[model samples]
Every structure is written in C-alpha cells, then in structure tokens.
Target: KPMTNYQIPQNTLLKFRIFNEFLMANERHVAKEVRDEYVDTMSKIYYSYFKGYSSRLTKLQYEEAAARDDLMGVEDTAKKGFFSSKPHMKNRSTVFTLGNRGEVLTTELEAPVIVPHAAAKNETRYSFECIFRSLHFALMDNCCREFLFISDFFMVSGAGSQNLFEAIMGKTLTLFLKLMEDSVQDCYDSIGIFLSAHIVYRYQSIMTKRNIPALDRYWDTILNHLWPRFEYIVTMNIQSVRECEPNKLGHIDNRPHYITRRFAEFSAAIVGISTTYPNDRVNRVLGQLQAEVENFILKMAAEFPHRKEQLIFLINNYDMMLSVLVERTTDDSKESEMYR
Candidate 1:
C-alpha cells in the first residue's frame, strides 16, 4: 500500500505533462491572448504548490531529519516562487481586540531583525582593539589612542570611510563634516563593518574586471583627499603644542603638550626607527616611501585641477620639513660616530 516516488496521480500527471508540452511548443508561436492565459493559469498553480510546500517544511523545522526527504517534493515550487514574485514580498501586520469591551488589544508586527547596539558596540570595540594590537606589534607602535581617534574620526565621517572613497579628498571633507555631528566610536556597528568588507570586495572585483592599475593609479586620488586633513592636523597640533607649553623646556613641560605634540613626534619617531641601522636597504625603503607619498600628491593634483596649486604648496612645505629632519639626523649620527 506504500506510495512509489513516481506514482503521482495518473490524471493529474497526464494533465501537467500536456500543459508542459503546450508551454514548450507554444511559448514562441502562440497567439498573445492564449500565451497570457496560459501564463496566468500556470502562475496560480505554481504559487499554490509553493505555499503548500513552505507550510509543510516550516512545520518540519521541529521534526526529525528523517522527514527532510519530503522537502524535495516542493523544491520546484519554491524555486518558481523565488524567481516569479521576489519583488512583491510584503510585510504583514495585524491587531486583535481581546476583551469583551475591546479595552484590551494585541498586536503583531514584523520587521527585518537588526543587530542590537549593545552587541554592535562590543564587536566594534573588539575589532578596534585587535587592529590596534596588530599595528603595535608591527613597529608602527606609537600613539595608541591617537590612531584610534583618527580611525574613529574616519568612521564617524562615514562618507569616505569605505575603502573605495576613503582616498578621495572631497569625500574625506564630507566625512569630516558629518563626523562633527556624531561620535565615530558609535559608527563601528558590527553590521556596518561587515557590509564595509563586502563593499570593498565588490569594488576590487569591478576594478580587476576593468584591468585597472591598482596602487599607482589610485595613489593620487587618495593622497589628495588625505593630505589636507594631514596638513590640518599638523597645523592644529603645532598651534596646540605651542599654546600648551609656551616654553618647550623638558619632558615635564612637554607632558602637557603631549596631546597635540604626539602627531609630529610620531612622524619623527617613524623616520628615526626606519633609519636606526642605516644601509642601502634602509635608504631604498625610505626613497620608495617618499616616492609613494609624492605620487599620491601628484595623483590628487591630476584628479582635482582646481586644488592642484594649493596641494603643491602643502607638498613643498611637507618635503622641506622632512628634509630638515633628515639633515639634523645625519649631523647627529656623524657627531656621535666621531665621539665613539
């Protein structure tokens, strides 16, 4: 008395096969009116089968895996539903009166589940901490909180926070303005971070498809956008440090100025560390780094002609300052070697 896999009702199977044959043959040659009617009829049949299968599988969620075999029965119906009516999915909401006097009411509401802030905040904090620790171990280890603050600023700005636009000067400015209104710390929601990774992946995929040059081509766009902010920080920190300690005497006097002084100090520290054991390798690396920075500026100027002169001015000032530091370092090294 057991049913066979292929033992569908004979009459129903026959009718379905006939309809299928008609569809395959008439799809291209059928009169418009007949095609429309056939499509409408088939659609209704498809949805009915779809709903029936969905209801049954939902019930089976609590059932044993042995019952999973039944899912195959409606797989075609489900596929039809997905392709045919995906755009028409609607939210369902209802209210019911419970009491005799209608004083008590019950409501049902549905929405896409979103990650809660408490969970999101924890995830953001964890990601920031992990990245911070990694950078610390990588010899770029100074200014823990300062780097965090910059990351936070970028996050809050949101405009250029995504990898694709982060290098753009205009987007960076837009993000800066936006950051003024919100805390960047709060912007690192887990979902936002996850989506950001996906966005970056998609951008890379498109760029690869287009056969674009990766580093050199995009360098200028990023530098032009990032350098103004860098310059702003330098200018701001110089003023702040000077204001904090009018006389730059000792570590004690500088302690109060550390907040703003950290920026310049960090830059100098990196340069010093890179040259501690000087060799051709060190010089070559430094040259490459400087060239990259210059390329970034050139790219920015090329992309934004209106601001080309202004950026060139900033680049010149930056180069001059860096050159002075190198000269001083060379002098001190020679003097120390002579004494030794």
Candidate 2:
C-alpha cells in the first residue's frame, strides 16, 4: 500500500513501543536473552525507520533503493512471543495490537514529496530551502522518538543508545548533508542560502536544548555546506568589481555607474547573509573580499579622465554603498565590522 514518507518513523516507534511496553513490564521476570532480543528488535526497527525513506535518497547511495519493506526481516521476530491484541486486522498487513504489537517500516509514497539534490536536474526547483526543509524537518521530527528510544525504552545512558542510534541513522543522514553541500555549490541565491543556514542554526540550538547530541555534527555539517558557498558567491561578486574593464569602465556620468548599483545590491545582500550567520571565520572571509572590492573601486575610479569626475564616481557609489549597508545593519550589530 502507498504511504507518506513520514509513515515509517511513527509506525516504527509505535510498534517498537508496544514491544517496549511488554519488555518494561516484564523485564525483571524476563531472561537476559529475552532482553537482548528486545534490544536487537528495537535496533532493527530503528534501522528500518530511518533507512532511506525518500525515493530520491534511495536512487542515489544512502541514496538507492533498499528492500524498503518496512522491517521486512524483523516482523516474524516481532511476532515471535508477542500475541495480538487486535484480531480483526489480522487480514490487514499492518496488524497492530498483537492481542497488543507495532510495520513493513516505510511505504512507497504515491508522490515523491522530497526534492532530490540534482535528480530533478532543475536548479530552480531544488532551492536550498526545499531540500533542507524536507531533510531537517524529517530529522528533527524524530528526535523526540529518538530520545524516548534511548531514555525510556533502551534505558541506556551516556553514548550507548546515542551511539547506536547514530550508527543506524548516520549513513542516510550524512548522505543528505553531503547532498545539501553539493547542492549549495550550485546555488547563487543569497536569500535561499540565508534561510537554509538560519534553519540549521536554529535547529542546532534546539538539538542542544533537547540534549540530542547525535544531530550536532550533522548540523555543523550543514553549516559547513552553507558558509563556503556563501563565500564563493561573495567572492564571485567581489571579483566582478575587481575585474571591471578599464577601457570599458565607461565615462562617469551624473549617476552612479551600473556596477555601482549592482555593488550596492550585493553589499546589502552579503552583509545581510553574514549578519545573521555571525561566525568569525566567515565574517573574515567576506571582510577580505570587501577589502578587495574597495581596492578595485579605487582602481576603477582612477580610470576617470578628471580627478573631479573620479570624485563623482567614488562619492556617489560610496554613498550608495553606505546607505544600503547602514539600512541593513542594526544596533544589535552582527557580522563583520570590516565592511563598515
């Protein structure tokens, strides 16, 4: 039967919890072998739950098509000692309530809702927000269940449960992060990049608060993808200013030159991107690019036939830059001071 991409985690958790309830109730009476079987069962459930739920994800590597039969091998074991609470659904494949249990894991969705990194082969549709949204939402949505898996059910502390959890989830998780990284390299839109980075930043804070350290590295991996591409775009912009053709510098007119207008827009955007990100290393990267742009502006100014004309070019353009920069900045004052 067709299902949503999200069908896996919740169903997996529900079924696992049925068994968990059984285990917790009878844990003291159960033998060590039984306990190990419970742990093994829960791990396999999670393995199926987090395993590539997205169609595009499987097509690629953490990416390709797996059996995706939703705990296919583990069902018979789940049914081993557990009896059904619900006999009516015996004909249905989902059979919850083993006299009370929990799934095939994930379903093949009728529509592939997730945006593929490049499988769509259309850059516009694969906006950073689209891919990031699908992955991060799915990732964080399961954290509560994950915490439960570790704390309430598994009863393991420190890294025991977390390590195991990451082990099962890490391959797909890392693949998406890597996908986002590669996807970001092709993104030229600052707003999309800014929004995606912002999501990761806030998601990291949320994970930290929830004490889910398993996702910390993944969040960092996402930011790592975002910032470098941002710097690349910034560098590309600065390079435009630096590479202005002297012969094509064109005569200084009564208005700011076309490049000047473009720079003002770029300045507003770059600073806007940097201000929210607030990392020293990234700030420095943009700062150096700004410096290069300033030096080139001077060089461009020198191309003017008259000193007064040079003043016109510099003063008007500088005024435009200052206006946009000042408007974009605030008293809270994030990002590099070097741009000012």
Candidate 3:
C-alpha cells in the first residue's frame, strides 16, 4: 500500500478516539458548562481506563502482538545492544607451540602485511582523474544541456570559470565539506553528484505530510538539488586545477594558495573534524526542527502567552497563575472540578 493509504489498526483507532475525547473536552469551541460536564465525565473515564484497565489492556495487547508477530523487532539490537555493549574482545592471538619431537608449530598463521606504494600512487592518480572528470561533466556537459531550463535565480551562469569559482565561494561550501569528508588518500571519493536528489526525495516525502506549499517545495528542491550540484562542481574543479599541478623547485608547495586552492583547503579542513566531531546528532535535530517548527510555533502561539507583553506578564505572575490554575483544576471544594 502507498504509505499515505495505509490504514490504522482498529484497536489503535479506538485508543486515539479515547485520547481525542480528552482533547475535545478541552476544546475552546465548546461551552464552559458543557466542557466542565465533559471534564467530569472524562475524570470517570480516565480513572476507569488509565488508573484501572489501561495497564491490563496494554499488557494484553503487547502479548497478543508478540504472539502474532506484530510486535516491533525485539532483538537486543533494536533496544540498547549497540550503545550499551562493551568493545568486543579479540578472538584470536598468535601463539607458538611445540609439536612432536620439539618441532615448532603454528595455528593458522596470518598472511604477511605489505604496503603497495606504487599501486597506492596509481590509485590516487586515478581517483584524482575521476574527480576532474566529474567536475568537467558538471560544468561543461550537464550545464550545457540544462542551463536554459534552470532558473537564473540561483545566479548560475554557463559561461566562464568564474561561475565555477562563484559556486565554490558562494553556496557550495557545505557540499565541498561533505565531498572532502568522503575523499581518501588513495581511494575514489564516493560519487555524490546524485545524492542531493535523494535528499530532496526524502524531504518531499516529509513535507507532503505537513502540506507544505508548492512554492516552498519548489524552493526546497532548488536548495537541496541545484545548490549541491554546483558545490560539487566547484569543489571538484578546485581539486582538478590546483592539486593536479606539478610542484616547483623540487620542494613540495602542495598547500593551496590560489582562490580555487583556498576552496580546496577548505575541503581539507573537513578531513579530521567530520570523523572526530560528527554532525549526525546536530543534523538529525535540524531535520526534525525544520519539519516541526511551523506546527510547534503554531501550537505555542495558540496555547500560551507568546507576545512580548504577555510573556512579561507570565514571567511576573508565574507562581500565582500556576497556583490558581492548579487549584482550579485539582481542588475539590468547587461544585464542579476539572479533573478528579
């Protein structure tokens, strides 16, 4: 089934219905007396369900799901195994033993370790060549065909190395960092020219649920896809032009000094930082915040004192208001109580 077409299970639907009753009772559209009556009825329902039968029902449901193979995967891997487990001990160690007649014996000796310097050099050369080819494709081939179709708002021009330079200097710094993160001394950088498309695909899937406007979605596509491609092109061009040059006076001056070389240096900056201080947590939080920010702000504005003066009032009277609200809801002296 399409993800959007998937139906919620009947039992889960009932649970949601019960949860929504509490929400409906507190709904602002309803009259205070009627809402108060609902609050009283909900007090009974809440006590009967949550304080009484909910735990038993939950237990039964879990057992049922487990038996029917409907439970979420329960392998230790799913819970805390990876995070909690200690480092694995090395299973094998080199050992020598005396064989019959004092002859030396070994148990499955490991192969000799050797560094293939020439092969490593050749691999590095090949990888650099690939980076150059990728840059060429981005600047010359792809842009030649697509430039007219792509909006000029990205300020992208199909002419000159200045376009390449601007792309690196302007908006591609992040992509350059990412590519540098993937690059290795004697290995090919993973071709991530198409990665932005996948990112946009995932972004669209998320935004569709929030009913994001068409214009915002369009801009999202441009930001995620168009910008990344240009960045890749610029970074690769930097590597191709500056790093490929022969050193002068037999002394190595491999440090990037030119404009493109500076961008290359920027790429190099990501080398150790990305591994030592990975941005996975920050990136995850960013993705979540971007998706939920609108709804979160809307909820806060609707439910709480959000204006400057209102917030000042809340800060000044925080204790008194809290006490009053708590008493109003929980105190039993009133003829009607919000909840029991």
Candidate 4:
C-alpha cells in the first residue's frame, strides 16, 4: 500500500528506534566495503541534488527576472522625465549638475553629467528565499523516500546514545518533516549528502594521520585540549544549548560535546601547525602517519580476514570519496566540468 502522510512520523519513529538499537547492539562488524557503499551512495545522492539545485537556481533566476519585469514595468521612467523636462527645468538641473563639469563646456558632453544614478536596487531577498524553497520542493518530490532510507540506516547504527539519540533524531526529524511539508526535500537532501560526505572525508583524513607522532602530538595538544574548551567558552557565551546536552554534533549543535569541540579545534590547529612545522618535520610526521595508517589497515584486514577484497577496494578508491566531497562543497558555476 502507498504510504500516507500520517504514516511518515510513525515510520520515522520506528526506523529511528530500530537504527539506534542496531548501532548499539550490532556486533557483526561492518566491512570496509559496507562503509564504502554508504560513502558512494551518499556521494551520488549529494552530487545529483547539488547539480539539480544549481540548474534549478539558474532557471529560477530567469523566472525571477520575468516575474520582476511582469510586476515592475521596464520603461525607463527617470530617463523619460529627464528628456521631457522643459527648458527651464533643464537649465536648473544643468546648473546643479554642471557644478562639477568643466566651466567652459563644449556643445555636447559624451555622457550625462550625473548619469541619474539608476538606483534600481531590486532587493529580492524574499524572492531568493522562495527560489531556495522551490529547489527544496523539487528535491523532496524526487528523493525524500530515498533520504529516509539513509537516515534510518544511520539512526540505528548507534551514532549516539539514547539521550543523544533523542536530540539528534528530534532535530533531524524536525528538519525532515518540515521539508516534507514545504516540499523542500531537494535542499535538505543536498545538505544531508554534503554533510555525510564531509563526515566520511574527515574521518578518513583523521585515520590517515593517526600514525604521525608530531602531527598527533600537535592535534592532541591543540585540538584535544585548547580548541574544545575554547568552543565551550563560545557556546557558554551564546547560551545556545543546555549545558547538560552531549556535544557530539559539533558545529551543527548549539552546545557540542567536549570531544566534538576538541576535534574541531584540533582540525583548525592543524592548518596553523602545518605552516609552522619545518619541511623535514612535516615530512617525517606524514611518513610516520602513513606507515601507522597502513599498519592499522593491515590489522583491520587480519581481524576481518574474510573481507580483504573489500578493504583493498576501499584503499584503492578512497580518493573518489574525497573528490565527491570537494565537488559538493565548491561553487558549481566555476568551470561547469567541476560538476562531473
């Protein structure tokens, strides 16, 4: 039977509960292949929605132009008035206008002295919002059901504990429900895809850097210590989230976890640290981390013995995931080929 609107909440709630349990209880151990599958699925969804949105926004600009023209007549009223003014009016206007002009004027000036400063600021803040709304609607129409599939999968995979679960689920569901109602699933989907890909890419980068002693030391000291606390201070100032809430959501949350804050700080610190590190020190750290990551991969392969092929696949194709993430985050209009 086709699902009704009323069924959505119930389905989402059930899925959330089920997914949370799976994450918490599943000891089956996911293969690298499985993780890669999620990465690929997420990338595909993100790129599709992103490209579709760019196209829709382009069309929307044209449509908005047409709508504005339809509403505000295009004839240059100011020009018409200036041209139609009587000689006296022109002389008076000229005196005020020609004050800045050369004292000994030729028969004609190449351009208008003041150019009337068109001042046609067609402030379309509301229209832009509507265009965003339209893009969302288009996405939801096509991909909402599929999005629920991924959301459900993540929810059950023990991404957070019950309290954290409720918070994340509540927020995610609220956004989903709003998108469903407003028919803006496309925007939501695009964001979700981008976010998912971003998370994966970050995780991969962190994993890659695990072996580097200096890098790890830098991250541990800067990110794990100073950064998270700094973020906590900012959050306290904003008074955004309850002090008691878990900070797992990072920047997405008003009050993120200390760990989440640490991660952000650490990541931020790396950018600064990279510049300070001597070339030899940087190379040494990178070499160490690469060896460690390779060792870790080998250990994972051994433990999952049967999944060697999948691990190889992931190692070989990881760049694709990063590429998708970069494409999603970049401005689409620059070099249309970036979309591919």
Among the numbered candidates, top TM-score falls to: 2
Query: Can you write out model 4's per-residue Cα lDDT over 1-340, one digit (the tens) per residue?
Result: 1113434654665555655455546733553345345446544544554454444343432121211111101122322335565231121111111122121112211122111112114322212223333333333322334334434555532233223233322333334334333332222121112222222233234334532111222223222322233233222322322221222222221122222222222222222223322234333433343333333334333433356554563444233423432433333322113224
Candidate 3 pairs with clashing backbones: none
lDDT of each residue in 88-166, candidate 3, tens digit only: 2111110110112010011211112111243344432222222322222222222222222122212324343333333
lDDT of 1: 0.29
Q: Report lDDT (Cα) of residue 247, candidate 2.
A: 59
lDDT assessment of candidate 3: 0.28
Report every candidate's CA lDDT: 0.29, 0.54, 0.28, 0.31
Ranking by lDDT: 2, 4, 1, 3
In model 2, which runs have C-alpha deviations exceeding 4 angstroms?
1-126, 188-191, 249-254, 273-277, 331-340
Q: Cα lDDT for residue 112, model 3?
A: 21
Candidate 3, which segments miss by more than 4 Å at Cα? 1-19, 26-190, 202-233, 242-340
- For each candidate, how many residue pairs have backbone atoms clashing (under 3 Å)? 4, 17, 0, 14
> Candidate 4, 158: how far from true, in Å?
8.6
Winner on TM-score between 1 and 4 is 4
For candidate 1, the 10 contiguous residues with the lowest summed lDDT are 92-101
Query: Which 10 residues in a row give candidate 3 its minimum summed lDDT?
Result: 94-103
Candidate 1: give the clashing pairs: 167-222, 169-225, 220-299, 220-300
Please estimate how well model 2 matches the true structure, expressed as its whole-model Cα lDDT: 0.54
Query: Which has the higher lDDT value, candidate number 1 or candidate number 2?
Result: 2
Backbone clashes (count) for model 1: 4
| Model 2 lDDT, residue 130, Cα | 45
Cα error, residue 301 of model 2, in Å, equals 2.6
